[model samples]
Target: MRVWAHDRWPFPLPPRHTYPQSKYGLLRERLIAEGVCGPGDFIEAEPVRWSELIKVHDVALMGRIRRGQLSVREQRGLGLPWSPQLVERARRSASGTVQAAYAAFQVGVAMNLGGGTHHAGRDFARGYCLFNDVALATSRLREARLAQRVLVVDCDVHQGDGTAQLLRPDPHAFTLSVHGARNYPFKRIPSDLDVDLPRATSDTEYCAALESALATALTRDGYDIAFYLAGADPWEGDRLGTLGLTKAGLRRRDALVLDALRGAGLPVCVVLAGGYAPNIADTVDINAATAIEVAVRRTSIDRGGPDAKLALEPRDAA
Candidate 1:
């Protein structure tokens, strides 16, 4: 599977900042080291053009971001200090999802090593997110006539408030978010479908809720592609997450979502949404596991396996 990464372009962060900026690079290295993906499978993402961003974001907001003119309140809401490199990084990160969405059409699955910036709304940035990557990808795909119907499966511990706000009103898009009920973005925007698991929810309960949610979300069969925000923060070890899912359980969560999407015959674009494990390595481990799952599925499809045949069969694209 092809993976998009932008960690080579580093952005500055405050000393001892809570955000795990290192995990992106670590994940890329580990995936190559473990042979889950070859170095050639990794592609360096370019910064998304401002014209493409304006299709989904407000013009004023884009101007402020580009000119480094964000007010103190806006900066506070963004959670990251304004810098040229920061703006460049956000553009590159958003570009990765757009690139991955296009790549998924060729391969059964593709991945963006860093993304899932679902908290940035049309005119606002919040919760460490500066741009709604999935929304941008959706818009780009529609403009190109590659996909009219899109599904966003956001499993981050935090609600995808920005994504819900931007895409929920579109008749052709389905936004389904399974997140901690009491987590960040206390004033949540509703997705098309939301399954809010309680704090300290166990893996079994989490999977059960997710499986049911997937069943409901996949009932309609015309989605051209699905974007999966396979967040690692739900792990018990994560500082920012309140769930009780173990590493094994998170793997199960990935399988449940991937299998359902594959069964629905929708190509998958996987992204590393959020992971704040106290140990950075743990976050890397979880993200790597998600990549491994995508790789395994791609291999299955490439070898003319049952999954390949299932994927090739025509689906109702109404």
Candidate 2:
């Protein structure tokens, strides 16, 4: 399996924020150590081009961000204090998702160590998201004929409102978001397939709903590719998550998601969405476990060899 990552790309999260040592990072390290991927498996990802940003993002807004010129109001809007490094981190995160999609095209699955910035919008940014990678990646894939029908499965605790709004009228893509009924992005947009779960939903029920939704996307909707935003905040210990799933339950959650795609012979690109726990290590560990689960399953099927790499992904960066 091919997994995409870059060292020193995150925004240098605060120690107490619980986003710094996120499990997705650990999962990447764990997957490498566990033989899911050799050292050579990871390839450096290219940053997204300005033209790609123009495809779905606002031109003036893009121009402002490109110059590291966030207005005083804009700074407060995204919450994090602005910096060039933050800009670089956001760009890399966006491109990482694209690279992961390309990697999945080469293999049955690819993991993006950081991405799924779905809260970003065409003309604005919010909730730590500076750009909408899902929209950018999907556009690149469709433009390259890598996928005729793309399905975005966003399972983050917060709804992929930005992605949903951007792709709402796009016929080539299908946006499916399963999130907490009352969470971030209080005003939710309508996704092509929206499933809002109640607070404190059990693991069994959550997995059941996930399976059904994925099944419908792969089998009935007939998507050529799938982009999964596997957020770790669904865990019970998450500082911001309202769901009540345990760590093991979260693993089973990944199983249900990956199993659906693998069973349908669909290639998938997975991203780290969000996870804010009281402990930064736990948050990081949680994200890592989710990634481990996806890689473990992907590597198993991928051992069948190169034919398993037929999943198409976007190749063009510009």
Candidate 3:
């Protein structure tokens, strides 16, 4: 499996900001240390083509961002100071997901170490997200005719409001977000399916909800591809996350999603989304478990191993 990472290139962030920009680089290091990937497996993502970006984003907003001309209000909405480097980072980060989509088609699975920017809408940025990478990638794959239908499973603590709105016009795209009921983006937009959990929701409750959501999606015609937004923020230690999922619970969650998708013979592109544990290491470990889960499942598929038996099972949601 190929892992796309753009954290090697440093981007400027506002001083005193609590956004763990360092987690990107740390995730890469931990992946290597844990043998989830070797140095060669990590590919640097190039900046996305403007043509591909404009498929889901607005041209005027893109121009303003590149020119660093966004008003103070707009910049605050992005949660970052506007700089050329920041712009480059956003472009490259989005590109990583686009690349991962193509890679997933070639391989059984692929991953983006710094993507899952689901909060950026077609015309606006929010919650530290400058661009909606997964949305743009879904559009690109559809335009290329690489996939007939796409599924987005966003498990971030905050709702994928921007992605839900951006892809709302496309019937071929389905978005599902299971997030905190009361978190960032208080005004949540609807997804194709949303399983909102109350604060302090445990792993069993979270996994049970996920199983039901996947089953409902499977009731329709199957999708050609699935984008799994493996967010790490649902951990109990996360300062920003209100739920109470443990690290073991997070790993099981990843396995449930990845195994089910792969068992259904759908190529899955994994994206590391939101994660904000009080101790950054905890967040990194959770992200590591996600990547390793994908890698292991992909390897099993490659060896013609037994398919996981959890793909379409029906279960009651907690």
Best candidate, TM-score: 1
All-Cα superposition RMSD per candidate: 5.3, 3.3, 7.2
Local accuracy of candidate 1 as per-residue lDDT tens digits, 8-43: 888899998988999988988898899887776666
- Best-fitting candidate, measured by lDDT? 1
Rank the candidate models, highest lDDT first: 1, 3, 2
Stretches of candidate 1 exceeding 4 Å from the true structure: 299-318
**lDDT (Cα, 0-100) at 229 in candidate 1:** 100
Off by over 4 Å in 3: 299-318
TM-score order, best first, reads 1, 3, 2
- Clash pairs, candidate 3, are none
- lDDT tens digits, residue span 120-139, model 3: 99898878888899888777
Note the Cα lDDT for every prediction shown: 0.86, 0.76, 0.81
Q: Is candidate 2 or candidate 3 better by TM-score?
A: 3
| Candidate 3 structure lDDT | 0.81
